[model samples]
Target: MAHIRSRKHAAAPQPAHTALALAALTMPMTLLAQQAAPAAAGAEATLPEVKARAAAETPYKADAVASPKFTQPLVDTPQTITVIKKEILQQQAATSLTEALRNTPGITMQLGENGNTTTGDSIFMRGFDTTNSIFVDGIRDLGNISRDVFNIEQVEVVKGPSGSDNGRGASSGYVNLVSKTAAREAFGNASIALGDASRVRATVDLNRPLDIALPGSAVRLNVMAQDFGVPGRDEVKAKRWGFAPSLAIGLGTPTRTYLNYLYIDQKNRPDGGVSTFGLPAYNFGANTPGAAVDPKNYYGSRSDFDDVTLHMFTARIEHDFGRGTVLRNTTRLGHTEQDFVLTGVNAVTATAADPASWTVARSRQARHQTNEILTNQTNLNTEFATGGVSHSLSTGFELIHERQNQVNAQTLTNTTLPASLQQAVANLYRPNIDDAFLMPPFKGAYAKGSTLSAAVYAFDTLKLSDAWLLNAGLRWEKFHTETNGATFTAATATLPESLVQNAPLSLTDNLLSWKLGAVFKPTADGSVYVTVSNAYQPPGGANHALSTSATNQASPSLEPQEGSNLEVGTKWDLLGGRLAATAAVYRSENRNELVSDGATPASFSQVGRRRIDGVELALVGQLTPAFNLSAGLAYMDPKIVRGVPGATGNQGGAIVYSPKVTFSSWATYKLAFGMTLGGGVRYVDPVVRNSNLNNATSANLPGTESYTVADAMLAYEVTKNVNLQLNVYNLFDRQYVAAVNNGGSRYVPGQPRNVLLTANVAF
Candidate 1:
């Protein structure tokens, strides 16, 4: 836990609006020096209205990708894609989705995972666990919440084994999110940020072009409001509100229809972080007391909370069946509801040599979750030819009907522990505990379920020779799980005796998933690829429970965790085409996995395999029109070479948070007058909290000690419609430890420097 201390003594001074935030970096560098533009040169005949006005102001990278449902290009997508537009999350004044995925890198961010519910949003990519692979415009988005990029307009990631694009995902990557539709032209924007513990946020967007009821209709609206916090943890908080509305209906006409809706409401304050037994000023005595704490100490419970509600509705219909055939149909209907009363600690095992005579146990979880989904996807794109080759087909069908409900309860809010303790401990720098304790009633419903999926898919790119290309795809699904209910008599002595519900259980599966790729294109801006994919995950995990095993009642059949990915990549489009570079090398595996049953200890068996080999590099867009970049780097090596045998899987451990290296970069320029400055640096190594792949027994579990973290930004265009930005997060205020609890007791820190100041206003 303690391994950072120099960004000039971390943080504590500076603010006086830091000289009005360095004078708003000077009105966007005097409007980029009065709209520079003077260097003359060659021009032989290359006009398509100046390449369509440089692709409409090139908002930094993203030349294609509509979820491999076809819109390829990202240099002909073979695999490995990243994209996070929305002007790089408003130049990093990011608002969630893990700060816009830290601008591309081998994603990692564990934060919570002690009990199945760890207060939402967890991540780990490349080395696996994309926390259910997320997605929005592309559907999915089931449980474990926390997402918001206001109304996002970009955030793709994709990467590997997308079994032909999402059906059970993330053999190594997935994260789609693209919303903010409806547009003919009309516009409006708004923003507000301001940060530092009392962080506040506001956002708004509006668009309209509706001629009322018909005539090239259009409508859009987005809204968000926040009251954020969590810099150094303490009374961590977050208050949220969201809304998105969209509508569109024929504009250029060929039959189009869209109507989207989203809504979110969140209430926060849940951060049970800090504590690592013996950190930095290590002093392992009383069995392993801890010290050097204070990354904003806040031992959970201040009336711990979490309440969320999300809503979604989508409808899309496009019809173009003319020569290039097209037919789309999308229909979504979502709902999510979460309730919480978190507060978990437990990580003190007798030991109290000092560190205020250690002790510190705390628990009080209570939950109520709900999710509902009703999807319907239908697609058909076309182009055909045969012998001379030319394919580009795409076919799809999807139908889902999901339902899930869960309720967990527990109370033992440590009234300073004693009554046979469910959580009792105190004194880790000050004893006593009680935050108006009283929060355990949420019985009813232990877990409910329903799942029905039916899918069909097809894809083909072919084109085979004008520079060879040959993607392929396949998909087939048919799952049907049931379990209308399951109970635990409300909490029989800390439950988890391996639930047993032999009545009302049902299961079924089919899954077929597949993918293949090849691209060559040596010129349209370069590409070179090779891909292979497959994915699965059937057995009732995302809610379709089957329970049954309270000491084995003939229920032990769970299957479906297959996975695959094999990649090789290259993408170019250098300078002349406005930057973009990429490289990849991958290998991922997961033959079944889900081991742990060397004679049933909570039973689980799937033959485990787990692997991950990687290499990646990237650089994106506009290296010049006044610079604009986004970088990435990776090196993963997740392991578990075989079946389980302790020490975290087999071949020596190492998957936990899986970080063998990761990097994130950010760049911005437009210097001289439209002022913009940028900075970026993020490194992450040292991980292995448990999943053994033995990094030499990861110093007794609880890993995460490498750190870099830095960020900066400044913008000004104070009047191109008003703009002003400031950003800066952890600009080296690195305290490091962001998640680790393989017994090192608790953690989750990493956030210090902090600073944000925005004011955008568009029109």
Candidate 2:
């Protein structure tokens, strides 16, 4: 049994100001203790477990994941699910969600924000943008901020429409982050790392059983601080710090309660990236439209920045009725805010004939956005036998109340520019500009809205016989949203309403999502399955803020987008059920997509359609006791089936950011003397932009090109309680595009070769 000899935090006391900020996040709750030094602590290591049990949990590498409400093993579930565990993250030194997701297949990043707001985690899977389809511990995170993984236990990428799991999952799928919680153990671990470009990061984790007399009671704390620079970019950097704490009462008892909280503060020197102009179809040859700028060029001002803050608190209770019945309830409150300015660019003189003459017209966008959510969930799980069959059933319900606020206005250039937004000139070929430290002047509010949603769902897995299994689920949701309709003048001398007109607002929608599947198990380690699922996304909630009906009165007809997926897949447990592999063929489509009606100006109809046909392959887990591997590949064709007359290009063509092929693979092997080696590669095919698709000018749009990058890692366990590790990213230092500025001229440059060395010690 694990026992504690002393009661102390894991780290040193935080500064008074920092302490105050943390205290605000812990308002009603109590801050038990921060992590203290591990010098006198006892070192411990054991297999992963959701809760304390008599036996240590089995490690299947990346084979199994329990997300939100899932109780079945990934191999037993019918849908395609990819699980990335803590071990995999450490091996890759992936500190953020984006870095970790790049290791999967068919994923791309897009810039999110209006004007100068580039603070969103614009991730796409399959062929659709899934920026809002992010969840933390089953609750929607409800913002466009990049999320950190410092306190996450694992990440589950559920492929395909997931409205049944979330109210408004993206057409392609959703990402669920399972956070670390209080565990019944007495162990502590800490790590500090440094890398290229003056990168510095420190992290700590401590889990302590609180009381000896109490059978099940413990508290866990996690903290992280980091300051890092973009290896290839000039003056681009990111800095952040956060803390997570969880406490459990009656952890190992029949009746248990848990409380979890998270707080994060971040600031970044945003990168607008390189331009997409003149390049050879294959190289910078004379064939393409314009010259390719050096990958290291900085087109945006160095003073551009993105700042964000996030806080969340959750409470959960569970009761076991013995005999295979359990009840669980969870409630969470979350808030997030973002402020930033991004450099917008227009090609002025970029041409292949005079490649060196390329210059860009530059402007700035300033934005402030905020979101808040209060949600609750309850579920009942039970197993019973009837007649000649056994059934595992789960039923749940959820309630959510959310609010979104956005105020976007650029800096006013009050001079010869005649009170216009900030405007400037930039030399794209070779930047000669410097940071101006310009920020947006006071502007009126543009959008304020609130939403309330409720849903009830049930799922059942029936074992008709030993060889065949059936699964079915259905969810009924009621959603309502409306504009706050508040008026504010900003108390200015001449407040022009032009800067604050209310966009289309107000909506009421009822959504029904469902799933069905059948499985044939020919062997204990293998199964073949067919599954069908559907999701509903209401009109005007695409960006979380609904379009006011008043602003969209011209177009009277609107409806929720309908998406469906049909897949046939097979999963196998190889090498004595220690390794797992999955292969699937599927078609996913979205119908009734909102598009403008040719006959009417500013009017739209749900007559558009988009679809993707694809095949996916994944292999995860151990090939041998000493070797672990995870690999995935996807081939997809996404196209538009309808068009808008005035939308200019992008119709009847491949969608933006949807690559035809993407592949990733990572493997680790253990050698003698506690040494391990790891390596992986990522490949992405060329991608197009929506606004310029199918246009002759597309050559000037700077589309993403096909590229392959590799990464490597080396680690040695000096002792059972100490380990040393190193990770090298972009091993070949390939120059490539990481992301486009989302329907804009600015594109992101990929990272250069950089290395991080870490010393991890456990007590």
Per-candidate Cα lDDT values, in order, are 0.71, 0.73
Compare the candidates by lDDT and give the number of the best one: 2
Model 1, range 490-574, lDDT digits (tens) per residue?
3357674444443687777788888888999888789898889888766664556666653321232656777898899889887
Model 1, residue 528: what's the lDDT? 91
Window of ten residues with lowest summed lDDT in model 1: 8-17
RMSD of each: 24.9, 7.6
Error of 2 at 396 (Å): 1.6
What are the runs in model 2 whose C-alpha is more than 4 Å off?
Answer: 1-63, 112-117, 282-291, 350-358, 411-423, 432-437, 485-504, 548-557, 597-603, 645-651, 691-693, 742-744
Model 2 TM-score, all chains together: 0.87
lDDT of 1: 0.71
True-vs-predicted CA distance for residue 167, candidate 2, Å: 1.9
User: Which segments of model 1 are wrong by more than 4 Å?
Assistant: 1-109, 112-122, 129-146, 149-171, 180-209, 212-214, 220-234, 243-252, 255-321, 325-356, 359-382, 388-390, 393-459, 462-651, 657-763
lDDT by residue (1-763, candidate 2, tens digit) is: 4322211111110001112223344332222211211221222112132243221222325544554245455666788888788888877888999988976899999864323435567888999878878877767777767788889878889999878877676789898787888887799989999998889999999999996676688888899999998787777778999998887766645556677788999998777656666544422223335546677776666667889998887877665554456666667777888887766554455454565655666666667888998776777877788999888777999888888888765443323134343346556677754645366554545677777899999888888887898988889998877774333344346765444354455677788899899999998778999999998777545555554443342122466778899999999887776778899999999887766655544666667788999999999888877888899999999988775654464467787789999999999999999999999999999887553344434434546779999999999999999999999999998987788665445677788889999999999
- Evaluate residue 661 in candidate 1 and report its C-alpha lDDT on the 0 to 100 scale: 84
